[model samples]
Target: MASAQDPATAQHPASQNSNGSSDPRKSLDGVVEKEEERKEEELISPDTSDAQPETRAVTGWKWILICAGLYCAIFLYGLDNTIAADIQSAILETYGDVGQLAWIGTGFPLGSVATILPVGKAYGIFNAKWVHLGSVLVFCVGSAVCGATPNMSALIVGRVIAGVGGAGLYLGMLNLIAINTLEKERPAYMGGTGVIWGAGTILGPVIGGAFADSSATWRWAFYINLVIFGVLLPALFYIPSFNPQPGVSPVIKLKELDWIGTALIAGVYTLFVVVLTLGGVEWAWSDGRTIALFVVCGVILLLFMAQQFFAILTTPERRIFPIHFLKSRTMIILYACTACGSTAMFTVIYYIPLLFQFSRGDNGIESAVRLLPFIIVLSFFIMASGQLLGLFGYYMVFYLVGGAFLLIGASLMFTVRAGTNIGAVYGYEVLIAIGAGLIAQIAYSVGPSKVPPQDMAAAIGYMNVAQIGGLLIALAISGAVFQNIAFHDLNRLLSPLGHSAQEIHGAIAGSQSSLFVNLPSDVRDTAIELIVKSISSIYALVIAAGALCFVTGALLKREKLYDSKPVAAA
Candidate 1:
């Protein structure tokens, strides 16, 4: 053994390989001395920490496979969420009015948003592998329950179960890859996930229409989730409990759980939705239930902010929410755009089909099938936007394109008379799809790009929370508008025909075709015209929403998309 700094080693610090052979020391010729050799007769081996993450190039393939698994999970999750919308007709037919039927769609995302903080907090304390597995299992159980349920209440419970599991899985899966996979590799994985998710949206309506058209209508929605979950569970089991960074925990391992903050957010959000839900249907907008709920929601939301401020100041474990995120200009703008874009996109999807049924005289299957073009265009544009982000290094363009397309789509609806050509109707849907594709990919990508790598999961979960929250909020508002237009038109016209206000309201509210067709010939034509008028007006409101998105996009600071660039270390 020779010390390189010593006079003797300086002459020739010749060292054998680990086998004590001197055959050019296997190439580098001991240019790098073994760490173990410095300490003892048996040299200390280099620790894994000293090695490059993606050593072998062959090791990269393993991660690609894991990413495929994650993509499947995202795909199935999107499919399940949207498929219910496709089956809304079946549920409404079975359960009666929109008010009674609304629970089917709201329950899942509600559960997802509610469970985020808890699951996120757990990610630090528990192993992500086990946590993700439990999430998949929970989702499976929910699917089973929904598939088996005979009643709406039972079905809603299943949706909640699925939501809870999905929240954990969706949150955990990305971070599991982002945190574990090599930096240069993440973009492809993320891009792949986006493609899978887009593909799922593509398949949902066609598959949903086919299944729901059969006797199994709603059950098929859950069945698809079950089949994918079946495949995903085993893939997840293959991921080892290896932490990329481990063997250390902060001195304070847990923040005092933000039970109060969590409860307040849930209360405010739910109450807000409730207030909107009652509007134009169960109670007038100014009625006691709706008014009181609005008041309470506003109060609770303020309290949630108050609680978050206090938690950030006092908590040593860096509270469930990071203080940095709240203060980050990039984060706030991205979140706002996500909320707005999501609200507009989902709101349009939810009601447009119903409008088609009423004004275009299309059935549920026809409407669902019609959206295939939208989904196709959405998928194509999402990829195009990804390439644009790669080339331009700016996220703002997606917002711009999406906002512009959405506005275009909404404005085009003004021409949607009852006799508008089928080609014209399809054009509007295509415009929406193009705008949606641009927005959806950009919206999902923004939070991750803006937030710190360490906060990626929390941010993603938060992003999803915003998206869904906006969706529900927009649903309430849009539904209220639809109700008002339908209500006024129903009363104004039908009352003159000698039908009572109550009778007119009751008929349309039930989603019955006879609500229009049962009238006298001229009156029926007028009722159909009213239907055309009310629904078309809602599209104008959606255009306003798109305008708001454009404003936010203008405000967003540009973030360069470095597809292969590594996330900065915290």
Candidate 2:
């Protein structure tokens, strides 16, 4: 373990005296510097230092098939993030509950955030192959439920269930790659996942719109997951199992779970999301129900923190949330960077379509197609960053570059209007896409490299929490922001246009049957201006997120991550 920093130090060798021998003073300084670095590592390192069990890596066609299956599963997870965006009108038409419509988008991330840590822990303790298979099966079942759901409530439940499965699948993919690939090869594989994920996220609305606009119906958006799963079912058998605690009994492993901690944390996040989701849309900010929810969320958060400190439900070694991450400046900065990057990326994915839909009168498919410039550039850069990092070994550069792009791009987007040139809007989005794609998945690769094999799961879990939780929080807040502002401004200006309040509400609610569409040409143009103004205002949040990401990137340690020498995980 003492030699783990050798590769980094070798990358920047200490200076020597003119005689080619190290100067005494410089030697002393080098020793002191090395000592300080060791102290920092110890201060932040996890309590467990046990060596992981060795396993045979899958090979040849088996490896190829397994990788394909894993990539497809991740694509499904990413697709779920924005599939509902283009089909909200269709779902509303069927369910007639506009208030619950947001849940269609929020439910998946909430479930993922609420359970990501526990799922990460489970992967560490259980048989890897079985757990991965179970996760896939769970996701398939959730998709089935969503496809067949009779109402919005059932659909929301299915989204949540799928989210839970998605969390496990996501972590499993990372863990599998960690165990299976060589250090030099890992970044390329991880980057491959990022590429697939970005594609799925960008393409989600396109697929959903096609379904909604066709006789196949919007329900096929979920059923599509099952179709992919069935196609890859055979590959499940090829995923080699590598349990960290192989002989541990099922009963002992069950007892090892931090159930109380899981429940407390879930309650806190669930309440927090609920408050955000319902506060402005369903209830006033001053409503008693909203106030009560905030109070409960605060209390549960305190209990969760206390449980982590006191080890009440599980020992420090088995705690789902890693407490030491709070003390490590590197982990803190990485968490913040991941969060901000995710928030910025997802904000655009969910809202940019609305810009086209409202201002340009583009339908779901057309708006989705319009995003190709952003999507193509983002996907290419995401894959490029991974490959370049694999070769160059400086992860910080991507963050700095990406952050700068996000800040500049988001600032430009903030200035856009309904009548802005279509070409210019496309250019602004590409800038943002570059920033978001670069930083989006970098943490997954870098965070694990900072820790030993035994703590990789926790590190991955910590980053996953940031990645999913950030998007959940962003969506909740941005949705509230967009809804409240749009409703107020539209009602104030359009009520005198000979339109009923319901008609204005219906138009903004994404109802295809809204009578607001039948307004006189000049009045409709005015309404479009108002709609675009509200949506564009959300970029202010993206700008803030991008600025934070840049700050964190500047704070990261300057060092190389890969070398000929092994990383000293044992």
Best by TM-score: 2
lDDT value for candidate 2?
Answer: 0.76
Residues 335-416 of candidate 1 have per-residue lDDT tens digits of: 7766766665666566666667666666657777767666778668767876776678778777877888888888887568
Model 2 clash number? 0
lDDT of 2 by residue, 137-200 (tens): 9888888899999998899899889988988777667667655665466656765666677777
- For every model in order, what is the number of clashing pairs? 4, 0
TM per prediction: 0.80, 0.84
Worst 10 residues of 2 by lDDT: 1-10
Tell me how candidate 1 scores on lDDT: 0.64
Per-model RMSD to reference: 10.4, 10.1
List candidate 1 stretches off by more than 4 Å: 1-69, 242-256, 312-318, 443-453, 495-517, 558-570
Candidate lDDT scores, in order, read 0.64, 0.76
